[model samples]
Structures are given as C-alpha cells and as structure tokens.
Target: MPWTVMPTFESYAQAREAFSWDLPDEFNPAVDFLRKHEDTSRTALRYETPDGGLETYSFDDLDDRSDRLAAALADFGVDAGDRVGVVVPQKPQNPITHLANWKLGAVSVPLTVLFGRDALQYRLADSEATAVVVDPDVRETVEEIRGECPALEHVIELGTTDAVSGEAHAFEDLLESYEPGIDVYDATPETPTAIMYTSGSTGPPKGVRHSHALWLGRAAAAYNYFDRGLEPGETTVWTPADWAWGAALGGTLFAAWHHGCTVVGWPRDGFDPEDAYDLMARHDVTKAFMPPTALRMLTAVDDPEAQYDLSLETFASAGEPLTSEVVDWVEETFADVAINEFYGQTELNLVVGNSSWYETRPGSMGKPLPGYEVRVLDPETREPLGRGEIGELAVTSDDRRVFFDEYWKLPEKTANKRTEDGWFLTGDLVERDDDGYLWFHSRTDDVILTSGYRVGPMEVEEAILHHSDAEQAGVVGVPDETRGEAIKAYVQPATDDYDPDTLREEIRDLVRDRLAEYEYPQHVAFVDELPTTTTGKIQRRSLRERE
Candidate 1:
C-alpha cells in the first residue's frame, strides 16, 4: 500500500491545517521524537552494504547510541556552538555523530571522503572545527594534515579498526563504554545547527550556517509537501550519503528523525541500476529521494519493472532539474506514485517543491513551498520581474523560515548574495509561469548566447532526452568563431548495441528537427557516463574544461 494513499493523513486539508503553519508546542525538531519513542523498538534503520551485510537499528538503538556518543564527545571537551567535522559514508555512524554533536549544542560539519587533503584542510580551517569524526580509511588524510589544523582537538574513527593509533578513538567503543542519558543541552531555534559548504566551481567551498529555526521550518515544509504521510518507524533510503552530507544529514535524516522516520543509507559508489533496484526492494523502503542522475540510471534499465517491487510513496529528486522522461517512467512503473521535484541549495533548504496534493506539471518545479516567499528578480536591477519573465530566483529575507543566516567566515560573499531589501540572490536564472509553476533555466553563467539567441541548456537537453538511444545528455557552450558560442552536447548512450558515430549523427539530426537551428549542438561526444560530482550533478565545469 502506498503510505501517502493510506488514511495516515485524514485528508489533504487536515494535513495542511496541522503542519502548514508553525510546529505545535509539543513538537521539537530534535530530542523530542527520540526521547518520547525510546520504547518503540520498531526498526528505525535497515541498512545493507555492498558485501550484503545487513544492520538493523531500532528507535531505542538509535537513541542509546546517540546518547552514548554524545557523552563521549562531551568527555572529549566538545561544548555548545563548537564545530565538529564528520566524514563518513551512508552508515549507522553518520547520524550517530550528528546526534552527538547536536547533544552538545555544537555545529556538525559534514565532509565527504572523496575530498582530498586540500579540500578537507580548507573546510576544517574555514569552519574552525574543534574535532573531526571520520571513517578509518580516510583518517590518513586527516593525520597527515593535523599539523596545519590547529583547531582540530581530536579525531573519532567510524570503521571496524582505527587507522591511526592512540590519536583516534573507535566510534563503537565510545558508545559501548557509555550509557544513555538525557543530558543533552537545550538548543533554541536561533542556535546555529549546521555549517554546510557549497560546492563552488571557481574557488574553495563557502560555508553557510543554518539555525535551528530554519531546520525546523524545513521539516515542516517537507512534512507538508509529503501530506504528513511519513509515519513513525517507517524506512526512507537515499544515497550518496556524505556527498550532500549537509542536506541529507541536516534536512533528510534530522528532519525525518524528528517526525519519527527511520533513515536508511548505503554505499552509492558506482552507478549500478540493478544494485539500486535490489537495495530498494530488499529494504522495503517507503520514501526514496535521489538526484536526476540516479533516476536516469533507474529508468534506463530493462523493462518488466514489476520484478522489483518498490514500496515508495513519495519519490523525490533534487540537486538539479529532473527530466520529463525520468519522471514519467517512475510514475508509469510505480503505479503512478507521485514523483516530487524540489529546488534548493546548501544555503537554503526546500523553498520550492511538488507536493502530493498539488497537481504536477511536466517541466515545472511546482510552486514555492509553504512558509517561503519566492521572487524572480531582474539580475541587474534587483527588482522583481513580472510573471513569465526569466530572472534570478530569490527568497525573501523577511520570512526567515527558509533563508540562511550567513556564509561563515565570508562576510563579503554573504553581503553580495543578500540584497538591501533582504532578498537572497539564488544566482539561478528561472522563469515563472502565470499559474505559479517555476521552470529552470541554465545557471547564470551557463546561459548560452548563439547568433543573437539566448539558449538554456535544459531546453536543449530536454529535446535530446526524447531520443530513444540517448540515456543522458549535458549541453554546454563551446567557443564559436562566427556565432560567439555554440551548444556542445556530451551524451551517454542507453544501450551498448548502437554505433557511437551513427547515433551522434542521428542525435544531431534529431536536435536539428526538434530545436532551433542555432540551438542544436555542433559538437557531440558519446561517453560511458557524464562526469559527475558525488551528488550526481554533471560537473559542467569539468565538461567545459575538456574543450
């Protein structure tokens, strides 16, 4: 049964009336759910690894481990407002560390293992992290740079064995040695909950601090979007764990946990459609959230999709605009289970989303989620643009619900992003239709100008996705002598049987027929897969660098 379709929510209006405004007095984003349901021994987390090893944790298990971890961190001299860095994969230890940091009223800095010494050093120094919790394998990177990170007080390893002797504390050992208690400090809505770093194309990452109120408001927005259908003790699985560690850790895990949902994580290393299907099926997941890349891979798999029975009620994708083909395949295969696409960055949480109750449009990103005020402003003048005009998408600063506090240690950058009238400049160019649906354009810098035509890559990519053989396509601008700039598409073929050269020619012909003459890609390259960040976004900068 679909969790959302069930009477878990009495009605759409009821769910909205209950969660649409602010949270009730009894509800707390942290501690309340765990403390109240400590005895609800239902499986809060059901995880399986690449090796097929399974681990299950009940609500009691999560609460106990988190409390013990909190005590251990407190013992290590961790205190309120201190920043602690966590570098781990999709495992039980990830949330345990988050809860531990939250217990001491400290900010959790989520880092991925893929980040080498320079990225890690920069983040540690930038956030001025007091300590670090990382997987044992990645401890070597931290150990080598310990001399430079003077603020790093200790290192906590989260693997089977420690890579650094005496210097690192085994995560499991700390939990095993301690006992559960309710000694966690009380954090107010204004308390700084996290410092999430954005993946910047030009410079080092920018740290964005989010308060407890922002997180709480985000949870309410997610709950409202899902029609409050996510019940207590239900399993939700999302991949690329530490990649969007801040979003997944802060928004998904913490948000769901607050609503009494079990967050399931796994090692989403390579793109294996079969493995993804197997994991979803085996886990009996109720809610699944992923990026556009994962959805494309899942849709490209061979048919007879009924073999893998997915219990997903809410299938949500973020990070990038989703393709219509991917959304259609999911709904068709899953008996029309709603596929919600949300738009937001590390700086802000879910400001716009396609909720269950609302009707979904093919290429639109739905409306601004409740409690958030969205505006499309002229990039140059910073004045609001009328509907149907393409402009920068921004959130109102006065709302305070979905806005970020500031970029930690980067005041100048923060000031530049926020306007004098208190609107956050998203830097993303978007178009809003009369019906309030928001359509995505290319990133501000990625907008292409060819032969006096302003072309957005998404529009061209949508045309390419219609081709049967084309699994995924990324359109970028390459220098052109005559037209100033021309579209270059890098495509990943869905099947192994086709000839690359023939398909490339066919795609060009298809785009020429489907799109404007100047908008068609003059250069096409067939590859195994488009280069992507850990979060499954095609690193357009990397593709442009290839030219």
Candidate 2:
C-alpha cells in the first residue's frame, strides 16, 4: 500500500490547500511503516557502533524483534499507557524498544545516555516509569537509582547481563524466551507515544508528550526540508544527534521510516570530525540533518570535500541559528547540494524551515511548513507582531497537525505555554520579514544553547554553587564560532583567598559529575559580584550584554 497522504506542493499557496492530515482511528507506527512499504527485505536501519562494528536491520528483522520484545514486555506485566524509560546508546536496540513500546501501546521515554544518576532519577520519578531498558554502560547508574523510583519494577539490561543486579532481567534472554507474532495495539492518533524531556529555564526538564500521529506529522518535514520529494527507498538519512533528541528520533529515525528511506545510526563516545566524514562516505548518505555545531566542525576540516566521497544531496541543519559564514562554507564545500536551515522545539518538530521548494535565505529561518499556522506574537499582549518587530514565536493551538499533546505530568506549565485565546507561545524570540522569512533572535529565557544541547542556566549555576569556593554564580551564553553559543559563567568567590584556576576546575568537575557533559560552562570568569535587579535576582541579560 502506497502512502495515501504525501505532501507534494509546488508553491506556498498550493501547500496551504493541498496539505491535510488523515490518520486512521487505530494507528501504530510499526504497522503503518510496514504496511506502506511492502518490501520487507529493504534495509530499514544501518547502524555503526563506536568500536567500528556495523549492523543492518531490514524491515522484517525489525518487525520480528519488536514483536518478540512486545510479547516479552507484556509477559513482564507492561501494559498500555505505561511509561517505559529507555536509556541506551544509538543502536538497533534503541529503535526496537521504541517500536516495541508502540506495539504494546506503551509510552517510551528516551533518556540520553550522557545523563548522570540525579538527572536520570528526576525523569524516572516524574514519569513514574514501570520499567527501564538500559545498556550495560548505564546499568550501574540505573541500579543505583532503582531504589528511589518506587514505580519501577523491572530493569532490563541490554548487551551484557554480567553487570546487572537487583532483580534485573537480561534483554537477550527475554527476547529468546518470548514468542513472536504479538499483535500490535490499536492506538488513536491522540494517544501518547513518547514523552521526550527538554530543559527549561527555571525547573527540571519538562516531558513533551507526543501523540501516535506525530510520525505522520513529521512527513511534512521529511518531504519538504530533508529529502525534497525524493522517492521512497532512494534516500539515505543520517545525523550525529543521539536517539534521545528530536533531531534523531523524529528527523532521522521516524522520518526515514515513514518515507521508506534507509537511516544511518552511528554511536560514538564523542563526536570527531574525521569519524563523521568517514561515516557519511562509508554509508553513502544521500540526505543528512545535523546541528549547526556539527556542520561547522565538518566545514572547518581542511579540504573537506577532498577528504571524502560525500553522497549527500540535501543537507539540513537545526538546534541553533546557522551563521552566514557556515552557510557560505556549506555551499562552497558541497557544491550543487541544497543546504536548508530549520527551526522548531522538541515539543513541535520542524514548524518553520527552508524547504527544497522555496528559496534559501541566508540567515533567515524560512517560512512555516504547510500544516502549521506559525506567527510572531507580542510576549505581553499576545497579539500578532508585525514584520520587523521582534516577538515570541507562536503556533495556533487549534492546529493539531504539528503540535505537542501536553507536557507530561506538568499541567500548570503546559497551561502557561498557551494564551487564553489559542496560540501556543514558544519561548524563542524571532522577527519576520515581509517575504515570510523568520529571523533569529535571542532566547527570552536563560537556557543556554551550546553545541546543539539546551543547557539550563539554573542547573549549571546550582552546580557551580555546590563548590565550597563559589559564593554566587550567574551563567550566560556568549557568541561562539564553532558551538553556536558557548556557556560563560561569572562567579563571585566566597573568599578572596580562593584561586580562580583551582575553583574553575572544581566547578567544572561538579557540573560534569552532576549534569550532562555538554552543559558545563566552557568559560569561567571570577568577579566580585554579579549584576542584579533591585529584588536581588541576577540579571542574566545584562551579563550576556557584558560578554
């Protein structure tokens, strides 16, 4: 069965009228993908591990494994509407867990392997996950926090079981014991499929709940932004982002599967420019979407085009605003390839972007996609802002084509995101041009964007304050060449006798131990006091301006 609804628009006016979403009453992503693409022998995923091991999973292999896993999970008492936390590296098992969860109507909460015990505990506690799937590397962290999560009943270890303890079950053993051919659950389009967590300014990360139809909504992006009307099974998509992020989950994994394209998943301890270049050449990637930081690093390599045989025809970037220099470098390096920039939050993926059908404006996030109603609104009045005036970017809440269901377990925060009338306010600040292009502005909140990761300033500040030598700390994002924004910290010492060099290392170590590695401040400046308001609240904007 061919896809009944594929967005193919010649112009913006045609896109507005032609784009319509129609999901069946009972929809499962695994069922939908397998049904649409009848060729079960075609490769669905081509994964490369850090140790130079290559693995390929065809559609049939995926279906069988996921069915077995679903059956095994059901035997373990996992039910519909239950949350299953997945903490694993980028591999075939990660996507298997996701499909298995959808097959059983369970919500999969993908947690980054980079997260520490405290960070992991918060999400597990908040989501009340019934079971968690972990790789052997993260098994110890899960075991340490297993006691704190009362709702957690099972810990399924992936890869090796020797390190597992405390009522843990081996993932391989469960799959071997369970029978295949488990029935896929009938889920409504509105049923929650995944609860992806994203960092905010003031509190812990908020879980962005996405419906089962979220995969269908991503087709608008895959067709327009990534592959540009490429035929099914013709394009190969690749990204450096982990499965935990929307870039990899929605953009690379779901989008490719939805379109019947091969997805390349590479797992690495850390990003290396040489490894990235080698993977693209080795995999014959036809289309790729990467963060601005990764793109910049790849462009910085000497004779990048000469170094490898890049098969990329369409390249898209997100996570942060792309600089004009990088844009120029991309054009020069990958001659004749269309390089587009996209803008969207974790809640709603790819709302506004430069599509293949549209003209690329250097430094401007292109017009809103077909199904979304995007606009710039005044932060205070909730009124639409005119072109050239900076305001909060918003999307009409009535349009469910590309919108999040809600923030999981945070009704108050979810309510705060929307206006009384209808618009869902995105905390990002942007301005629009008369031509409908959106221009990037600073974030209204204090969350820092460094190398494609959203780093909460409060989290880093709290970690800095944990150091005995630190009295008070204010964090801000400053312009960076490689990393879209580099985190900078202004620290006030508790005593004048403390050494700045020593305190900096201590502060970095504290954050590295407590939070994700990408969140630690890259630059630390010792100061007597930080700029503050009359109420004693630190003025982060002022600190940003000073930088």
Candidate 3:
C-alpha cells in the first residue's frame, strides 16, 4: 500500500538544510549527552563482568572516563573521520569507546568480540580502520594475524594484560596517561558519526554509515514512545552492545542522552537472565531493550512470578522479528507491560515501530515513525503495491534529510540496491494489512517460489513450530523440475526421536494439516543442528549448498 502519512518536514528541499535537532554550537554527542546528566548522580551504567561481578557508573563518572579515553585515543593519532575497529563484549567500555570516538569525530567501527582473526582482518581492511579496542582474551587472535591486516595501526586492550605486542597499548594505561579534559569535535548533521558493518551472508560485509541526526532521531523516538519522562536524571540499562546490533545500544545511548538520561550496560560474557533481572532490580532500571532470544530465555527462567518487580516503564525487542507468542508471554509475565517491537536495519535506522501513544497490534511492527516513509513494492518492477498485496518492502528518500548518503567507497554496490525512484529497496518482503500494519515475511532471498506460488518460509516454520514436538526449524528450496523448486525443511526435534523417518513423516503431516498443502515441506531432514552465522541467522545458502 502507498504510505498513508504525508511528510510534515521531510522533503527533497529539506535535505539541503540539516535534519538534526538543534543544540548549542559546541555540542558533541559525547559531552552534550553525558554532561547534561552528570550532576543527576543517577547510575548511568549498571555493568557486570564475564566473571559475574557487578559494577556501576553514574553519568558524571562515565563522562570523565570517556573524556580521558578520548584524549588518550587522540594521543594514538586517532582523528576525525578515522575508522577505529572496536571488538569489546557487552560492557560499559563498548559505549565508552563509541562515545569517545564520537567526541573525536572519528567513525567508530564496532565489531563483535566473537569474531576470529579472519573476520577481524576483513572488517579492518574493508573499513581501513586505524586502531582496534579488543578484549584481552581475544587479543592473541588479532596479534597472530596482524601481519595480514596492513590498515590496522594500533591495538588497545580492554583489560590490563602483559601480552602487549610492540603495537599494543594497555586500555587502562592509555586512559590514565591522558590529561583531565579535551576539546570535543563539533559535528554537523552531515558528519558521519558511525559506520556499522552488515553481516553479509551473500557477500562481503558492507559498511552502513549514519549521521548524528539519524541516530538521535531513533533515540528520541524510543524515549517518546515509552513516555519514560527521562528528565536529565533517570537511568536505563541495555545489554549486549555488539556493534552489529546498533539500534539497541547505539539508539539507546543517543536517545537517553537526548533527554539527559543515563545509559546502563550489562556484563560481556555473563548475559544471564537472572543477572540482567538482578541488575535491573538493584539499579532500578526504568527502560530496557533486549533481543527476542533473550526474552525467550527470560520466560524459561524459574520463579519469574516472585522475581524482581521489573518496574520498567518500557521494554523493547529489535534486530529480529519478534513473534506474537513471545510478546504475549512477556505481557502475561510482566503485568501486561508493553513489550514494544521495532523494525529496522543497519542500512536504515528504526523505520517502523509501535509507540507508547498508539495501541500496539500483537504481530505488527507498528506504523512508520515520524520523518520517514515506507511502502511495499514489487521486487522486479519496483512498482508500489496495494494494501494486502505481498511484495518487496522499500523506503523513500524524498525526505532525504535523515537518509544515509551512500555506502562508503562502494558506489556501484549502493546504487545497485538503493534506487533513485526515491525507494531504497529493503530485501525483505512484506504484506500490509487493511489496517495499515505491516506483516513481515521472509527476506527476498529466503522466499521459496514453488508451483507459481510465493511461499514465505517464516509462515511455514511458524506453523511447524506450533507443534510441541518441534524445537527448531529451518526451511529452504531444493530444485524440482515440475514445481521449479520444492520446500525442504530441516528440523531439530525437542525429544530424543532417534528414528528420523517417523519424526520426519509426522512433521510433514503436521505441516500439511496446519499450513497450505502447497506450503508443506516435501522433504524433511532431522539434523543435529542447522548451520547458522555468528549472529545466529540461519545460513540458507549453506542449505542450498547441500544436494
């Protein structure tokens, strides 16, 4: 369907002017956000370590440490627009480094600590990153492959360690050596604040850049959506600040700071639901954003009824499509608290979501937020589709003020996908309902075409998962001359059903009963596990690799 809402301020003409919310000339995200809340004496960050120790940082404390770190990074020749690869787990140090880079007007390239040397080297070379902030445990991997990564100039370890190479510097020592204060970079809305690398299953990773305005818009929307009333004093704890998942960490950091609120973080490796619950209860976290997987794990915990009050005003889930079943469970467990789900990607920030003011639909990702336009379009012709028609999802840039400029140094690649018809084709397909809520289907690459019908694997899998015996499922298409391609399902059973043939037939029968006959899997394989990427996205390409 066509976008029902018209742009109030976002237009082609508005693009010439800045899209940012105006602040003082000296304003930088790091200082303006932190210093604005420094005196509140509220816990800015509630942290936990891999070894299960908890720590806290107030806004004032975080500001000081970040400033010192920014100054230290400057000493290592980090400058404006310089790319820095940071591979820290979910800790306060992640945002500290991120904000410090923002203060320096440098592009922060945050990498997941779980990645090995090859992944690290690829990102470093692709981004031409200047320095790396890595965990002490993972430093050896980078060190072993440093010779392969020529663009990487410096290494800063997060914890104190004696395994320093000639090129490595201690993170604590770097912070201690810097003087008290340094000048923060004054970035315009045009300045690129951060470059997030997409986990390209189809190809090499591509860097998606965001301006200060884009990041802040998402944050402000989140705050306003929750009615959190973050008035320069309150704090919010969000866990797992992996750079790939920037919407939760990056968006929360900016949004909390926009209202002068504190941003709390959880421990790196110890991401237990119990620890997260305790940290929130102890620190009194008022706002939070977690992945759907974490939420699922949270529901599985014991004595959730008697656990901490969980007095949070707003709780959200992003990155992956959250199922209605998960949402219902959260609402039931948490006194019907609004478990808001937002939809967006690395290429575009939070584009659509359920807000506090609006009544949320159970399965809907909500409507398009202010300052953006979204539509469902035919994948081939790029023609706008009517409501209830299933097609490719796209967003327009006529309201260009907030849109990304281009993929850095990858012009052909950017143009090949992001189009000039004002539509940036999001590879995912969707079907807009009569009420204007968008229902997410599989990615265009994941949609299985069989017998002249487009079958979304999510639909089939959701039906299959409804069966109690099914624990996990992955669906792909295998070549079939008669039908073009037929649906093939890979399942991991919840029970010890050693007889694959019986379980497979039962699953096929279950699918046939629940879903359309054409949508039922013609073949079922009971495997120990389905191949997945580092971030847990099932690699359908790998399935296609099989016969």
Candidate 4:
C-alpha cells in the first residue's frame, strides 16, 4: 500500500512544496492501521523473545484480541476519555492494550517499565488513571503505589485471570470472556488517544495529550526518514528503543504500519551490541530507528560486518544529537545505510528531521520538516529572531498534525508554552545558520538530557533527598564520552554524623531504587552547601558551571 497523501519528490525543496496532510474529519489510528491493513498471511508484528525464539503475529490476531479486550474493558466500567496505563514491554500486548483503549475512545498512557515507584506514581496520579495493564516485572510496583492513586482501580496482570483476586484481573481471561470484535468508537482527528508523560524543569512529570491525528502527523517524516523504502512490502522496520517513548511508538511502530510495512520487535533487559547485530541480521531488518546512544554502544562490537550479515538500508536516530565520530563510523561500517538524525520532543514530534532524499548537514538537524513552520524566537520576548541569533525554537501552534492538544489538565502550563499569537515554545535553544541548518545550543530550562533520556534534575533531586542523611541535592548534566551527557549530583549532608563515603553510595542506591535506572546520578560529590538563588532555590546552572 503506497502512501496516499505523502509525496514522492526528487528534491528537498520539491518535498517541502508538495507536502500536505490529508487528515479526514474522522480518524482513529487503531482502526486505520489494523483494519485498513488487514491481511491473513502477512505478518503485522514479529517479536524476538529473550530465549532466541521468534513470535510472528498477523493483523487479524492483534485486531481480534484488541476487539475482545475492548468489550471486556467497557463491561468493566471503562468509558470514553478514561485513562488506561500500559506498562508492558515491546510485546504484542503493548499494541493490543493501546488498540483496545482507542477502540473505546479512551486514552492510552504509555508508561515505560524503566520508571521505578516514585517515577511511576507521579504519572499515574497526575493522569488520574482508571486502570493499568502491567507485566509481571512491574505488577508489584503498580500494586505498591495503588493506595496513593485513588483514581486507579483495575490492575490487569499478564497472567491467568483466575489467579488474580479483588481488583486484580488476568489479561488473557478478560479477552476470553468476550467474543472477538466490538463496535470501535467513531472518532475525529481531535479525539484524544494517548497521553505520554515527560519530565520538566519544575514540578512532577506532565502528560502530553496527543489526539488521533498524531499518527498522520508523523507519517511524512518516517516515510522519508526510512529512505522512502522504495517498496513498502519489502520494508522490515526494527528498533531497540522501548515502545513507550515517542521515538518508537510514533517514529518506528505506527509509521511503518501506516505505510503497510512490517515491524520487528526485540525487547532486551539491557542493550547488548552483539545481540542487536545478531537480531537484525537474522531478521534481515532493512530500516531502523536506532538511538545515538545505542549506535555508540554498537561501535563496541568487534568486526560486526564480518561477523553478521546485516542488511540495514536506513538507520534513523533521535533522542540525543548524533556526534560526528558516530556519524563517521556508521558511514564506514554500513556502506548502504543512510544515517539520518532528527530532532523533536514529545510535545511536537518529527517537526524537524534529516532525510535520505537530500544532502544532510553533518552537525545540524536538517531544515524544518515539511508541514511544520519552525522559527527561532527570543526566549522571553516571543519575537522572531534573525538568522544568526540564538533563540528557542518555536513551531506554529495551529497544525494539529505537528502540535499537542495541551499538557493534560495543566491549563496554566499549556498557556505558558504558547505566546499571545500562537507558537508552541520548545524549551530547546537553537541557531539557524546561513544555510538554514538548525544548530542546537542549549535548553532554556535545566532539565538534563542524558543518554537521550530527559532526566529532570528535580526528579533526581527528590530521589537523592529521599535519603535520611541527605539535606539539599542539586543535579546537572555534565559532558560525557558515550552518553551525550552524564547526570552529576551535588549533595549536602543533613548532619555531620554520617560518613561521606557511605552517604554517596546510599544516595546512588536510593535514586536507582526510586527512579529509572538510567536517571541515577553517574557522578556524586558531597558538599557543605550548594549554590542557591536569592530565593534559596538550588541553582542547577551554578552547579553545572562548577563542573
């Protein structure tokens, strides 16, 4: 199935001019992807299990399961607009959970398994999630936080429904209880489908509300990013990035499905370079959305090309900036692979990215993507800045395809993101050169971007402060070799009665246990006091400068 609205242009300028969205008055991504691409023999999802076993699933298989799950959910009191948390890995269940929620016109919240109790609690509570579908690994964590989240009721585990008691139910049992197929909710482009959460400089994590139109919004970028594939049927897309993040869910997963391309899923406990190469080779993966961090790690693999018969044609990466060293290495290793790096956040994704159809500037996020008008604006003034001026990158706020609906329930924060006229102010600061390449400078806020994961210093600080011996904690991002930036923490002891060495280890362990494993501070320093503002707030900027 060739893309209907997406343009096939000879040049970048031609693509920009010809590109346009064909979002209809009514749209539902689940129905569009699953129902539109229905085929009995074609594989919709092929997951590589941990034991080196391959699980192939067709669209019919997934559609039937989602339909049954939808009926069960509706019977369980889940109505349209209710929030359902999906906490599974990159299994078929992940997509099934999402489709079932969308069929009900309810919102699906993609919560990553990387998050620990504290990180998980913030998203669940703030979204007022009515139910959570979790795997065995995270079922205990969700149960622990259930008391605090008053709105959360159902706890669906991925085991036998008969094994569960009280509010807890079996995922398989629910589907079996109802027959395959239900009335999918009729929706428009503006119907809210998913609320993905992201950490910020201040307060708890905020849920980014994206409507059904998000899938179509990301279509053009993915089509071009994956080298236009030349043929959709032969295209096999794969990514090690977790499905919960925008990079995987929108960029890799739905993007391929929209064009009727096949997708490969290989979930890993920890990213292994050798294992990644082997998986891709075995599956004959053609297109991938490999993050820069994963690419850098792959460099550690000894003679990958000679050892594995990898068939990658397009390798598109995001999350963090692609370094010149990694870019150079990829070109040398994979001769046929066109390494394209894109830039965007959860609020508005794929607005700016590199493509295989044109010349890519080495250190720049290629020209603003088609259908998105990106401008450099003064951080505080909201005025458009000149070509050479360094300012925050802002996108026109009206494009339903390129912008978020609002920060879920955060009216004031949502209002603060747009100016009087309407431009969603991305906190990222960049400068446009004479050639129109966007060069990143820094962020207006202090949220640390480490290992492509946005680690809010505030979240890490709370984890550090959780320690009994900790007093004040300040966190910042510092330069690192592998990870684009490493998280460093400056801790103040609550009392001199504790030993610095013991306190340092305790702080690290506390953070690791309370948050995502990656968000823990890589570098720790015991301090008498931290640099502070006149208002007595810990100044992360001052700590970053100290590094």
Give me the candidate number with maximum TM-score. Answer: 4
Using all chains and alpha carbons, the TM-scores for the candidates as numbered come to 0.77, 0.96, 0.76, 0.97
Worst 10 residues of 3 by lDDT: 1-10
In model 1, what are the clashing residue pairs, if there are any?
Answer: none
Residue-wise C-alpha lDDT for candidate 4, range 54-146, written one tens digit per residue? 899777888899999999889889999999999998888899999999999999999988889998888999889999999878888888999
Error of 3 at 302 (Å): 5.1
Ranking by lDDT: 4, 2, 1, 3
lDDT scores in order: 0.71, 0.83, 0.69, 0.84
Candidate 2 Cα deviation (angstroms), residue 469: 2.8
Model 3 residue 86 lDDT? 76
- Model 2 clash pairs are none
Angstrom error of the Cα, residue 138, model 4: value is 0.8
lDDT of 1 at 437: 88
What residue runs in model 3 are displaced by over 4 Å at the alpha carbon?
Answer: 1-27, 38-41, 161-166, 224-231, 240-244, 268-271, 397-401, 446-547
lDDT string for model 3 (385-418, tens) is 9999999888764345355666778888778767
Where does candidate 1 have its weakest 10-residue lDDT segment?
Answer: 1-10
Clashing pairs in 3: none
Error of 4 at 494 (Å): 1.1
